[model samples]
Target: MKTIKPILFFLLFFFTISCVNQKQKDQEEIKQTVKNYFNAVKANDLEKCKLLIEDSENYLGVIQGEFNFLHKNYDEINPNDVLLRNILVKDTLITFTNEKEKYVQYIIKNDKNPNNLKKPLIITFMFYKPVGYDKIFNRVILENHIGWDK
Candidate 1:
């Protein structure tokens, strides 16, 4: 009985450590994905961006329109600038599966005007790993809001 107890305890401890490590790894991957996406944007590499995204068709039109607007209005636009700013992440639940998901939000200024500040732009991304999948299957560009607070 004593031997069995120790074995059970060891097994539990191993599983606990594995779960923690997996969570950390997942978070790091999500952050890396975000970084890569922004890097592609900075370089105007639409192909790279499309590769990183899951449902490209859904958001491609919006992304292209935004790019056109930025290029027309701003002399120099860098996605890296916004990436260097505040980034927030929160835990989200998938309603149908009751599975945990990640919601990442990036908040950045629209213009270069330091004196007069307007509402910041908020870009949110949702990441989900489907059941039986080892890695995140979907990285959804959930929303892109201009002149929005946090």
Candidate 2:
């Protein structure tokens, strides 16, 4: 029994380490996905941007500017049409103590008009893990409002 106890202890430790490593890797992938998503917008590469996002017919989320559903087809989304003025990411604790983290995005908008190159508009995105049994990270828009400068 003594030998068995040591073997079980080592196995448990190894399993715990593996789980932590996997979680770290998952978070890194999520971060990269987010980076690619925004870089595609900044460089006006809408085609590249589509790969990182989930696809749905009614998958509508405002990208600032008075426009929603920028393009019926994800491939047709225009980077120039959707100006990514700025991006801010915030980390929040959700569950499992420090094991889980949430990211939020705050973006400013610029229009497609050639002549009107003035100040860009601002928008905020609050991302969080949804309730229920599923274990997934998702963006739940906590708030969306125009800039106060109006």
Among the numbered candidates, top lDDT falls to: 1
- Per-residue lDDT of model 2, residues 33-141, tens digit only: 5555555555556545434333311233423222222223223323443423333345666466564455545433333434444454333332333321122133222
- Summing lDDT over every window of 10 consecutive residues in candidate 2, give the lowest-scoring window: 132-141
Per-candidate clashes, comma-separated: 0, 0
| Candidate 1 residue-wise lDDT, 1-150, digit = tens | 989999999999999999999888777777777667665666677777666666666777866655444334322334435553444557888789888878677554655556545655545767776521222245434233443222
Q: Per-candidate TM vs. native?
A: 0.70, 0.48
Go through the candidates in order and give each one's C-alpha lDDT.
Answer: 0.59, 0.43
Stretches off by above 4 angstroms in model 2 are 60-102, 105-150
Candidate 1, clashing residue pairs? none
Error of 2 at 65 (Å): 5.7
**Global Cα lDDT for candidate 2:** 0.43
